[model samples]
Target: MVALRVGLALGTMAGAAQAEGVLPYRDADAVARGERLYEATCATCHGRDLQGEPDWQSRDAEGYLPAPPHDQTGHTWHHPDAVLLDIVRRGTAAVVGQGYQSRMPGYAGALTEAEMREVLAYIKSTWPDRVIAIHDRINVEAGG
Candidate 1:
């Protein structure tokens, strides 16, 4: 009975982990589609190579901050997948609330949820192995 309970518990934990980590980063086709979608939808503000905008850390005269890079140089990897997906779906202003102003517009109207996941996967695919491992850890820590 104890052994059966242990097996069930382990199975539940594995299922939870799978549910939390849903990005298809290893799928080459999804990554390619994501790259193209990113270029079409996000590159103008974030940069063609995900380099983001100049002076991204500071607010401009109008109080809007430039888009931050999605690459390792930026803090994108610091967040778990769920938070990143929310930001993409709701925009920075909506996510940060408290009257924070941003130039980013949510893609909720333009992209489907699966497409958003693809974009995030593409971004993750570009990170170095170390960064990817760190991001995986972040997701684990976030219970995502």
Candidate 2:
């Protein structure tokens, strides 16, 4: 009985481990739709390739930064899933505290949660394997 229980526990854990982290939010069609939305709504400022304008790390005289890249070069992947989701839904000020102004717009009313998830999934799918692994670990540690 003990051995059977242990084996079952291990099997459950293994199954969970194999489950795709992106699966819940991953919808290729939705991602494709998000890609269009990203291009139309985000690409101009963020860049067609998701690379922000020059000196993305530096702030302009107005205190606004050029949008940063979404790929591995930037710190986007360093943030956990919830943080990213919130940023998309509520804008930077929601998480960055009061008086923080960002060129990034809040999508609270503009997008449904599924649409937000699709956008994020699309972004995640573009990341390098290493970045994805790090994000996966972050998600795991975050108890997601």
Candidate 3:
């Protein structure tokens, strides 16, 4: 995990404190578990290929944002680790701090914390290197 620590250090600027949102994408077992969880739990709305739903940027008739892609093309990487975890645990309505009604369900009490981390790691695994770099910057800015 030295490389993970190194990457995280660079992303968080070594001494700065931040919410640790980065998952261990390099962990073979974690990543594999995550892929399964994602396909079973997340792929429906996010798309089997992580492309998200069509017109994901637009609001529905109820003014809720559709499921956004988890791929580099989407804004999932724009968020830091804490936010992602919060969203997964609390669902979109709670995280958005708005009355928006997303179809996303909170997996709190359903998936273990490790499972969530694994799932996120799997998602990150799919991003290209440049996207991963951007995500690292996002972590830096988010203080994680």
- Tell me the whole-model lDDT of each prediction, alpha carbons only: 0.90, 0.77, 0.85
Residues 20-84 of candidate 1 have per-residue lDDT tens digits of 46678889999999999999999999999999999999989998899999999999998899988
For TM-score, the strongest prediction is 1
Q: Considering every candidate listed, which one attains the maximal lDDT? A: 1
**9-76: candidate 3 lDDT, tens digit per residue:** 79666534333346878789999999999999999899999999999999988887889999989998
TM-score quality measure for candidate 2:
0.81
Ranking by TM-score: 1, 3, 2
Which window of 10 residues has the lowest lDDT sum in candidate 3?
Answer: 13-22
Q: Which sections of candidate 1 miss by over 4 Å?
A: 1-20
lDDT value, residue 98 of candidate 3 = 52
Task: State the weakest 10-residue window (summed lDDT) of model 1.
Answer: 15-24
Instruction: Give the Å error, residue 33, model 3.
Output: 0.4
Which pairs clash inside model 3? Answer: 18-143, 18-144, 19-144, 21-81
- Model 2 alpha-carbon miss at residue 67, Å: 0.9
